[model samples]
Target: MVQQRSVTYVNNTTPLSITTKELDLENCVNDNQVAIKIHSAALNPVDSVISHAANKWLVGSSLKTVGMDYAGVLVKRGKNVDPKFQIGDKVNGFISHAFGDQGSYSDYLIIDPSKQSAIGHMNNFDYLDDDVKARFSDFDINASYPLVFGTAYDGLFSNGQLLNSRSRILVNGASTAVSQCLIQIAKKHLNVETVVGICNSKSFEYNKKAGFDHLIAYDESNCLEKVQSIIKDKFNGQKFDLIFDSVGTSEFFPIIDTILKPRAEGSLYTTVAGSNKLKYTGGLKEYVSVLPLWNYAASWNPRRHYNYTYTMVWPKPAIMELASLMVSKKQFIPPLDSVYPFEEFQTAMDKLNTNQAKGKIILEINKDY
Candidate 1:
């Protein structure tokens, strides 16, 4: 029996449960599956948060393994695998095996395209234009981006229904990875008029360089006054058309009307970090539950006064293609917070949980690749 090294949760309730272990890999890939030799994988706050509360969602089976984003070489493929995928192609994307039984934090990962796993996407970024590529200078960008980029894409286009020239967005927790992706996409691709970011003093300059037209220091006194002033001075007093919250706090809700446009203007405020401190919302018998769409459902209720929702990123091969294309076109490059070796996930998670990463956090899974 063949075995491979992987990051697995010995139990579901603590980051301490996360550790590297070897597991049997014989027959891991079915005839329709593909296996990737992971060069790099990304760590998201969601990855760590879920583990502490994972048991509630894990069925009676001892579901292990954890991680989502990865980029690497397609080392093996089942005979019936899609013809578009070749054995030696560079592939990258996400796999959500019931929140993670077959995760990306491994030397190798096998995924089946036909099944729905939490949020799934698997594709290759053919970075063909080396001549023009800048910050996308390495393959690791592929691993660092997918999950957060997808979240931003879905938030702005799908949920926010962002009206290009007219939309003005305020990114709460703007220094977070997903918010960084938002800054790039909204300012560059969508050409939104005014993009503002709310972050602490240390990140003000970085957020500005990331394309936020204005940055407010949330740590400063009268942060709300600063927000109102920016709107009055830069945007003609128009309230934000969309507010993307990564901080996961309800503190802004009470003052919602002061910052966000009314629900009638087709405005929205969506958050991923709802109730940041996590506890299991499920029980022992629960087998599967996707990111709760109940929050999204609430947004559609006629009597609901606020247009808000909790969003979960979805798979769109187009997003992968777009990131590659933009980088090749010399448009903009995705930024990185830091890269850790495969052995240092705990340190990475510690940094992530603090919510202060300067950019995306990635694991250098196989440095040689």
Candidate 2:
């Protein structure tokens, strides 16, 4: 039996606490599954978030691999595996499931597309078999898109309700990878008229390259006041169609009534930021002060005027295909921040945990690739 080195952890630990191990590559999977030799993989913020949760609500042993996005060549397949996915086919995407043992940090991975691919969101939604298959000569770059871009696409459409080309949007944490994708998709695909992005002062030009029409420096004082001023001046007191919080801050949410259109007006305030705004500047203080999770039941109130929801990425075939098509047409660009060798994963995680990376941080699993 062959053996491979993989990153492993017991959870509830800091990113630097993660360790490595060797596993015998024996009968990795069966039935509608394929084994892949990963060439590249991408790191994400949620990687540490889930790890710190220590398998809460997820069943896993003390040991599990770590990673989500990966790009590789198929090496083996189960008997019932789809004929369309043959050995040697190059593919890349992400695994988003309730389990952690099946991570992509290793040189080898076994995935059951029907369940772990996040396609159709664990088959909860409809997805195509080939939706996750997109290859590029640069595996590091390919490894970056599936998670962030997919999240952006889902955040925009899954709950976006009835947005169209004329829609206007406000994106917090505009420099975030997912936010950048959101700006681009809303502008180029949906043809949104005006898209405003909030980032640090230094990233104005950088965020603009991601298709943000207007950029604001959140680092400045009275940021929300400026946001309100824009609403009053730019649209003549018109509310924004969408207020997306990518940095996890609820700072814009409480004042959303002034910044967003009402439910009656078909407007929404959606955040990917979870409970805390996770400003990162305040560290634990920020995490503890994260916003209260929005409840759907709140919408039951007859007097309710605002539509608000929190969403995470759910893999959908249509969205994945659209992204893939856009990539092929060069209509979508996934920003790349830096690459780390497999051995330097801890350093990579350090950067990611800072929430300071301008784009995706990739791990070149197969350095030769």
Candidate 3:
């Protein structure tokens, strides 16, 4: 048994609390699991949503932790585990807590091999690309990349399939961490030619650096009109072949038909963020009502030939491999906004709640590690 400090859920409406607890290593660590001494963890919007509305979406237990991404050292490994993973390897990955009650908000986390894990070992620092290695030498920045990059890769390439070089793509919520990665992957990996990003003026500089061909600021009242006008002029009235919406507001639902290619084959709209209402509201009734509303709106227009899909990232080995390769090749740079100490958990949550972070926010769990 080992005693460590961890953050645990108090209730649905209250914030998470930190406390000392005893973990039975013998029970938690199995033959197919890897035992890690977590050093840092990153925050995501999904953590806030789940913490606020756990009663409706989460099942199994009342007490839970509230994070998904972690970076740590592999202190122990199971005998049956892969020999490639040795002790003291520097690693980072994400653990989805959608179905389970446990999460990564602790000093120690047990990663099961069966789950959709995105674990990556970074001990071979000498093998890293010179440019990437020059920019980062610690775990804090590496901790922030897994979830955001994995989500973006899955949404753009795996599910959306924007493979054609001539495809014109539009990315909404371009200021988001995931969107930043999507823009780079679309340009570098898919060899996409025309890529436009919709974001506020504050994010214009960052989006430009991320390799967006065109940018539309959506902070003003006539933002939609401006977007339409940009499409008319820049694209010569040709609609987008693919629209990726990281912002799931109802506003875009009405204008989707106007911007999307009419009756074009392989045209698609994919969103990682579900309905805005479902993300904020609590209780079963509110959850039930939001689903039908989306269904009705999506099916209302017959002329909208493009298919609509709501996607959740399922981390796989291929996605992680792609991300790792990009990082090693100096093609992808992980954007890390801020790093907070583990004791200031509430402050970290407050920053994420604002939803204005330019990149990922991380928590340094064991500074001395």
TM-scores of the models, in the order given: 0.83, 0.87, 0.88
Clashes of each: 0, 3, 0
Cα RMSD of all models vs. native, in order, equals: 4.8, 5.7, 3.4
lDDT ranking, high to low: 3, 2, 1
Roughly what TM-score does model 2 have, to 2 decimal places?
0.87
| TM-score (C-alpha, index-matched) for candidate 1 | 0.83
Ranking by TM-score: 3, 2, 1
Candidate 1 weakest ten by summed lDDT = 279-288
Q: Name the regions of candidate 2 deviating beyond 4 angstroms.
A: 13-26, 55-61, 118-137, 279-291, 294-297, 300-302
Please estimate how well model 2 matches the true structure, expressed as its whole-model Cα lDDT: 0.73
Q: Which ten residues in a row have the lowest lDDT in candidate 3?
A: 277-286
lDDT of 1 by residue, 1-369 (tens): 444667776446534444454544545677988777788898876676556556644444465677888888876778887677777788777765445577788888888654422222343334434542333325567788878887887778776474687789988888888888888888888889888888989988888878888888878898878888887887777899988887665667667788899988899888866634232323222212334356567777898766888876776666666666566665656668777877888788788777667877888778774
Task: Using TM-score, give the best candidate's number.
Answer: 3
**Model 3, span 189-218: residue lDDT tens:** 888888889898888888898899888888
Query: Which model, 1 or 3, shows the larger lDDT?
Result: 3
Against the reference, the lDDT scores of all candidates come to: 0.71, 0.73, 0.75
